[model samples]
Target: MLKSEFAKTFAMLATGLSCVLMAQNTLADAPEHRIINLQAEATREVANDEMQATLYTELNEKDAATLANKINSIVNQAMNTAKSYPKVEIKTGGQNTYPVYNDKQQLVNWRGRAEVILNSQDFKQTSELIAKLQESMQLGNINFEVSAEQRNKVESELYIEASKAFQQRAKLLLAPWGASNYELVNLQLNANANRPMPIYAARDASFKADSIESQNIEAGNSEITVIANGSIQLK
Candidate 1:
């Protein structure tokens, strides 16, 4: 019985020693200094293809119902006016109502605001629609951005360029590292865009329908960027 126990203990110790030796050999074979991180970026200026604009009206009255009716009437008219431009998308939601207090802090009246938002890719149609709505509703703001389909198309092209740039850079770096070749350990790609909101040059909201005219607009451009981040093992 004692001999059997001694044999088992000796076998376990031998296995543990073998594992430690194998780990040490692996560490010796791996050159930690041979691995390097690399990054490459590509950018392009793309024309903005999408636009979003807001129009709203605010009114105050002693009666909440009357105030709501007036606000709703203005927004409804704006919505009806927008329907003429089928190419543009329209919606309404920014309805807000709050109490108004006089100097004595007494609830004297109610004030309410309603909004209509417009989204579209057809800049000309949207511009015309904005002109029509400005006759009744006040312009909140207008901004442009790259649409999803356009952004995806741009990103696909950028990735191709960014990947090639990374490879060229990696190949150029091999000589400095004293390596004739390298193997890609890992790779990652990312996309981003730099877009700034454009201000709308709006006139008085009370302008007559005939007085308001379609103004020329320039969406400008956005800078789209793609980056390639990776690690390479030199050989």
Candidate 2:
């Protein structure tokens, strides 16, 4: 029995030593905690591909129902006119009706306003349509933007460029520290797009539709940017 107990004790000691060696090996294989953080950006200016416009109609009437009906009629007519052009998308915007008050706090008349919005990639068609619609409605504003597909394409290319730039910068920075090799610890990419300012030009009410010329529109450049940020560990 004494010999058997001594053998069991020896086995326990061996097992404990093996576990300690394994723990030490694991500690040695762990990655270093040191890292370098960096950021790089790429930008490109591309012409805008999309256009948006809003048309408004306002009227005042003694009867609220009449004023609402008149506004609805104008919006419906605008929608019908826009249907001829398959490329231009038309939608109704805000429709508001409020009562005008006199100095004596008496309700004078009901004033109502309605909006018709237009969006398209064909600038020529859009301008022509707007000119025709101006006969009954007033121009609110015009805006230009890069389409989603175009912006995405530009951003994808910029992302690659920005990432490469980040890597180059990291190498340059690490060369002074004698770090010839690096491993990417983490990375993040972000994309941004700048929209052009809206143009607000009112049309002359006295101008006839036949005499009015189509608006000349220029799709200004939109700046697309991509940024890369992350940390790299020196080897």
lDDT (10s digit) by residue, model 2, range 1-235:
9999999999999999999999999999997766889899999999999999888999999999999889999999999999888899999999899999999999999999999999999887787788788889998888999998899899989999999999898889777878778889899999988778998865653323675463446789899999999999987
lDDT of 2: 0.88
Which 10 consecutive positions of candidate 2 have the poorest summed lDDT?
205-214
| Candidate 1 lDDT over residue span 93-204, tens digit each | 6789999998999999999988888999998888788778877778888889999999999999999999999999899988888899999999999999999776754556
lDDT (Cα atoms) of all candidates against the true structure: 0.87, 0.88
Error of 2 at 131 (Å): 0.5
Error of 2 at 51 (Å): 0.7
Q: List the residue pairs that clash in candidate 1.
A: none
Cα TM-score of candidate 1: 0.83
On TM-score, the candidate that comes out on top is 1
Q: List ranges where model 2 is wrong by over 4 Å.
A: 1-32, 203-214
TM-score of each: 0.83, 0.82
Please report the candidate that would top lDDT against the real structure: 2
